[model samples]
Target: MKYNNQRPVVIGVTGGSGSGKTTVSRKIFNELSQNSILILQQDSYYNDQANMTMEQRANVNYDHPLAFDTDLLIEQLSQLLDYKAIEKPVYDYNLLTRGTETIHQEPREVIILEGILILDDARLRDLMDIKVFVDTDDDIRIIRRIQRDTQERGRSLDGIIEQYLNTVKPMYHQFVEPTKRYADIIVPEGGNNQVAIDLLTTKIRSILMQRGNDKIINNKDSTI
Candidate 1:
């Protein structure tokens, strides 16, 4: 129920794995001052599989909606939008575990919720002031995923391929793709699309300025 009347502008950016959603989100973040932006990555909300063995965890369909601790993510986002601080959770893909240390995230003027499945949930979607979906070719996405998983997430090439075929592809079809219809904007080629980024940036800046203008007018009236 809290809003910029008491909260920040909430932006949701989502897409399929390796779809450059993060790149798009990063572009938006870079446009703003560090103090004005708060980024919440959806991967950080993955449900912990501590009780499961490594083998069991590896079998989990991470692309599935059930794979995320959506409730917790929703709660954390709600608190942040309510002008409250939260301890953001951290998930480690290398270990397939949640880290013990949490980041103390303070409220900011702009909050970006970045993930593959962000638009899939109505509750989360309802909170967003601006919603974006990055559209890219599946082949391109898979290639990027393979490279990222192998180099950064410490995944084997074979394992990545297997997972992509077994779960990631199917889940994207079932869940992620369908949610694209809900987006206010569809960004083709993700962050590399300078035109889309420019238009978006202009709109965001306009909103920021309007809010500032309102505050200034309110102050002047108060003195009168």
Candidate 2:
């Protein structure tokens, strides 16, 4: 049996809740599709809430790193890096449960993995070639999260505030903020940091272009 270390490039972006990791990931995905790209959101890997009753789920602390199934996530990511298709779990925040369904993703030249705790997990962090941390003020993040949850996730203002005050803020200080040291790039102000985003996009383009050129010479379908 043979193992392959040379796999698709992986980028990991992590940050505190509502720090704009998702926004950055989406932007990168949109910009990098010329050579095909797969985006995996760590939020989708949240542990299944099926075992818990509605009340239990309601009381669950989602900000904890343990709330996610990191082993499964790592396995799926490794498969993608090996040029294999993977069915990634889809977590529903509104229902506070992991659906039976998953999104089937094909291997691509680039894979962007974004989440709050991406850098916190040592095993997963080792997989990323480029690691980014979005740094935003806690007040700003909380405000954005409240708005996002209320509008997008169907959460009430009171509920959002309660969760942030009780679970999100403390967990961020404990687990997320300290992981900033691991980032190759630190993006401040989340999605509003255009300069940082552009720089990152350019870096990605250069890598893809270089690799694509080589692949083309080697008879690989180079679409970049």
Candidate 3:
């Protein structure tokens, strides 16, 4: 995975809901940032669901591919790939909208994009140098989702169950499940899979070394 100086490597990490994709992304980001890597989350590109009334939003399936502003994300990613400067959008979960905070990201030697639907869009899939899918069992995923929504997302048990049965499970079967075929690697058991995580870390290190970036530490200057 040695990257040319002129090109930026894009790594995509995707999985179904409650698959611990975020946790995997964080681990990879930490490992790669040792070589001056920058990470982005596709969750930041979720379309403004807050603006719509509860009725409108209620009918909306947040897990659907159409819920994200893929075009805008692609445009920004394009600029980054071309080594141009761009402002990345900041998404607010509480407001459920795109926020005012804009992060300026310059070209990095490596970029990691993590989300549940990163592989769903063809354009996004084309941009990835490496793509990974984290898989968890359906029942386990549902339980995890219930815990997360109830504790972190301020959702009731009944509401969480309703959403899971009504929207999440169906969407997983329709959209997320099919995209696993596109992954270069599939990680099972989520974060508990230490062997897979170690292998990934080793691969990332080897690639950075080949790129002559082994010494690129994440200091203030490197990020700039």
Best by TM-score: 1
Q: What is the lDDT of every predicted structure here?
A: 0.82, 0.81, 0.81
Candidate 2, residue 165: the lDDT equals: 86
Clashes of each: 0, 0, 0
Q: Which parts of model 3 are misplaced by more than 4 Å?
A: 1-4, 49-51, 215-224
Tens digit of per-residue lDDT, candidate 2, span 1-224: 12234467788989998888888877776665554566788888989989888899988778898889999999999887777878878887767999989877777667788888899888998999899999999988998898888888788899888888899999999999999999999999888888888899888767755565334222222221
What's the true lDDT of residue 122 in model 1?
Answer: 93
For all predicted structures, in order, the TM-scores are: 0.90, 0.90, 0.88
Q: Which digits, one per residue and each the tens of the lDDT, describe model 1 over residues 1-224?
A: 12346457788999999899999888877765432666789999999788989989877888999999999999999997787989988897767878887888877777889999999899999999899999999999999999998888787899889989998999999999999999999999988998988887777766766776233211211000
Cα lDDT of model 1 overall? 0.82
Runs of candidate 1 exceeding 4 Å displacement: 1-4, 213-224
Error of 1 at 172 (Å): 0.8
> Which pairs clash inside model 3?
none
lDDT of 3 by residue, 64-164 (tens): 99999999999999988887778888877666677878888877777888898999999999998888999999998998888888889898899888988
